[model samples]
Target: MSVRIATDGSATTVTASPRTLTVCVVITTEERAEPSWVPQLEDCSPALRRALERVGLQAGELWLHLLGIGLERGAPTAAELVDAVAELAPAELRRHLVGVHVPAWRALVGADTLEAAARGDRNADAVLLADECYYGGRARDSLSLLLPLSVAQTKKRVADVLRRFHNEVFAAREDELVAQLERDVDAKRARSLSPDALITAATRGYVYEPEPELGRVVLVPHLAARPWILLCQHRTTRLICYAAEPESAPHAQEVRARALKLGRALGDEKRVLVLARLAAGEAGLAELAESAGLAKSTVHHHLVLLRDAGLVGMRGNDQGYRYFLRAEGATESSGVLGDLLAPR
Candidate 1:
């Protein structure tokens, strides 16, 4: 759940700069997301309540074993859930299915033997359940609890729940979700290419991690909570899966300042003429003054502002200042129009 990028941009071009944001990746998944969805949700009251009413069959092994412990409100019935998983392969289903007490059961899995988890009073602290096994004389209430259904039942139930959640919530919104992420990637790229590059993204679910080789940041949309984005490492990819929310402006303040400055700078008749003259070729103070029909001092004053704003630069001669747009500033400026002109 952490990523690192010690260097900035490509080594071939800009070389090293400060590493503000290292590696980021965005991925989408209905299946992977289910593990954390109903259980850990901040506002579980609604879903829990709904589960009690609408989720009639809570008997599936995936839901029962994983969401086990205390069933307060939204637990589906055991029979309905077990029936859902009845078609899966027994061996494969057995692999993931477990008793209601998963923590104790998982501990049993990691240990060399069930006896490995033995405590003072109990000879065995946990037990692994496999078809008609734990529920019968071999295990059950002795070392472990009964699995709600067989492996086949758990598998089918899991698939049904996953398919249902996807179609109901995520499928219709997939394209729009991906499109928003693409805009974010484009915006980050624009900043990454700048001279003093920095990435400024806000998320509640994730934080910056340190790594030597930083990969690209991507967006993963989920039926997750707002602003909460989960960051995890996937081989070379740094995946950021977040609870879905509507798209907000990217780096909104930077876009506004850039737009305002550039707008005012171009709003004058005299300044426009000076820009036109400069575009043709480099010009000194006197040359630009003559072309604009303005006094040398007035033109000089404008040139000073342009330079300060990063729209003008000093020539190779050093003595002469030439008015030219900075690539860095333009890169940022381009995104402003894209943001403002975007749908309200």
Candidate 2:
């Protein structure tokens, strides 16, 4: 199997250096579970909920538009972050909010589309609809809300919502949350694993194969994102927020969970076929799709299950990620099952 290292002299060899990849552990109030809007309403504080309604800002919208606050260096307090929002240039705010740096999307939407949309240009809707990624009702709703407002108006609304959110919702828990997130970051750094291993461990076996276009990976630990890993994309950086490993479960329960998950992942015939293909060599999504004679999306689903079960690893080049079997995980699956079946 071939291993790909970061080409920018970040590390000489993956095995030789713990920091083989340029991975940064970031902590910020702006790091919400992605799409930032989908968490259950009951999960939100009454103050936050009211603020959302007051401004017609979905919880996700406020964060989606303000996440640039997290991208800045030197973690700022929640109050400072809220204040930073008020100071961003209208164009800068929009750019940061809509960090959709996809080549095709950019080609279709053009350089001036965001400002045009802010200016209430009618053609902006048509341009946005051209991309399949924006076909969703959610995207339409977000566009509706955003496109109607001038950029300056959008900035004011975002700043106001964030200020209220900081004062009412996050301020109380900010220190405690920051402490927990920092502790996770420090503890993970203490492990001194290579970037590949660090990401896999922090994300509980989910490997982020960095493509040629990606220069950096930022891992942020978020308390509100428990039981889920969140991904956000910037021009050259990918931010991943993962839940800290739960300590509350009994050891046996944890083992049983792992064993059962492996069983379920290996139980599927199509997934097994995908694994078989990976065993021969690392392959991209299209190749796996063709080998399995399934749609790309179907193959992608199988990949997710296999990856979650720790049965697969991936590497990236200029084109995209190539999936390979992780021999360690495949070998460990049997031992996991054996432990569950063995005498307690």
Candidate 3:
């Protein structure tokens, strides 16, 4: 409920100065419903699906790893759509699987926009180029949020989706889409949004909330975890947010639990090695200890913690106890870790 992110000299008071815009969160009336005035988000859904499908399974795991149950429960298609991309791919093609990631390559709203806006200089271009996956904005955290996919691959997929949309969907749906967008714009103009409302709505799972200084803030509702903050890192700064719904209050405990588990499991180098080993297959405690070059007791202790965190599950056999990672748990834990690391 409290403001977790703050910028120096940010407007503490919700005074009407300038900088506010609202576009439809967007949704198609339905696949076959009569065209209505609703600003359709049909494109956003497919765009995400296509992007993930283009990227493949690595994309699926990555999205889940970063977003946890949020992506699994909310934007299910995103990860599920690409579940087989890597498996069905040729070795060379599969090798091209870079990776999916949290945050994103760059903030839709770059640091440039944040600084400029703070100076009372809003950039129009920054608000124009909002990315479809809008829940990412911390420009400084780019390196840590790295994906496995190459630049070329991402670009190619984006281009291909756009091309397909241009030829098929957009051609048939442009009028509807644009009409709804324009209508939403007009409707938003009739209402005013306070700064507090803007910040609260803009933020998602992470602690860091971005308070960009802009005269014209455009909120594009999305179904992703974070609101994509496209800053003006390049051209003109566009303060646009492809916002996903905030996590329900009930789910907060789960997020915190996952984060804590990942934290405890990741704190030691030996445990990390244990996790890496388990990634390949199950290993007995002796093997894990030898490989990690830690004492048996030490390794056992690590395993205990990992097991409790649900990072690893162990079984007893004729030889002794063997441990293997709970892949889903690991992913969910890691995803929470990403959320924890997001820029404040």
Candidate 4:
């Protein structure tokens, strides 16, 4: 049987034969404007678009529904937000819909919103508010645990829709059998993870020790160390170590000159400089911008490119995200510049 996927701006739907699955990607735009909120819609939007694309659904096959809510409150309460969604969503869509809210302040608010959506006692379909719920907090941890549960429920819904569609439209009795097989496969994958085995594997790693004879570069792990070049192997995921020595000053200067020339050739001098700086150590975005002589936004844009190229890495702490060069000899860069920068 054929399947249909549809979306309004706020919600998305995927329908296969016996089941229809409705997902609310965004609950309201007003909550998005909160002072405490950080915009992740850029990342989320791409992920949702990709998921729909993978399932072969185009814009025409999806419906778009917009929730017309104004942004006045610092952050809307779960109840207020839910009322708005229920009012806007069609009654037929309500029964099949699953809301995904990005809570702005408390992740528990997201969980609360999900429960509210399932009950549908309010005027709205349960608003999923965008908030700082997925950062390094208890809510973030809780949300991670909830992900698998949500996936399981959604899978079941889709299977049910497919089974019904096949029987009614395709006149196929094997539809249920096919659905069961899919469920079995999913179950098998889930059961393969044993907690005791995972714990044992994690505890079996050796202590960190340096191999000085491996290269001229010394990794002190000092907070003030300058950025060093790292070479990463893409396939094996190993880093090749290399130290930039004081004696290598002339070569380093030449490499910098070459980098500048390459940057100019690519019409992106700032990016090249940013990559060079990150290869040296963890620098603030502002510092990187100043060193590269570019605006902060421009520096960020360049960093994104460097990050996508696997020349840079980022880790988020409580304060914010810190950018650094991947450690030398940790990744496999073999013949590429990723390797050229590593300690040898």
Best by TM-score: 2
Q: Please tell me which model should have the higher lDDT, number 1 or number 4.
A: 1
Model 3 is weakest, by summed lDDT over 10 consecutive residues, at 15-24
Q: Which 10-residue window in model 4 sums to the lowest lDDT? A: 217-226
Candidate 4, residues 1-344, lDDT tens digits: the string is 21122323322111111111111121122233112111232333454434433322322111111111211121132234334434443432222233232122123344555555444433222132223332212222222222223333433333333233223322342344334323422332344333222211111111112122211111111000012222211111112111111122466564554354334423566676776776678887778989998877677667654543345665532234567775531242333344347685
lDDT of 2 by residue, 1-344 (tens): 11335655753222111111111211224434223222354566686565455445433422533443545633456676666667778767766554344332344456577446545566875566345454222344444455556778767766666776566556676666566566666677778577778777887666666655556666766655454455554556565666664443687887887876687678889999999898898898989999999988688778866776778866553335678888788678878878788886
The residue ranges of model 1 lying beyond 4 angstroms of the native Cα positions read 1-148, 193-207, 210-223, 231-238, 243-245, 249-344
Model 3 lDDT per residue over 17-93, tens place: 11111111122323421224333444455664454345441222222222222222322222232332222233222
Runs in model 4 lying further than 4 Å from the true structure = 1-267, 328-344
**What is residue 265's positional error in candidate 4, in angstroms?**
12
Q: Please state the error at residue 27 of candidate 2 in Å.
A: 19
> After superposition, which runs of candidate 3 have C-alpha atoms over 4 Å from their true positions?
1-52, 57-154, 198-217, 221-344
Residue 135 error, candidate 4, Å: 13
- For each candidate, the alpha-carbon lDDT, in order, equals 0.40, 0.59, 0.40, 0.33
Better of 1 and 4 by TM-score: 1
Clashes of each: 21, 2, 30, 58
Off by over 4 Å in 2: 1-39, 42-65, 100-110, 118-120, 133-144, 156-172, 204-215, 223-229, 233-236, 248-250, 263-305, 317-319
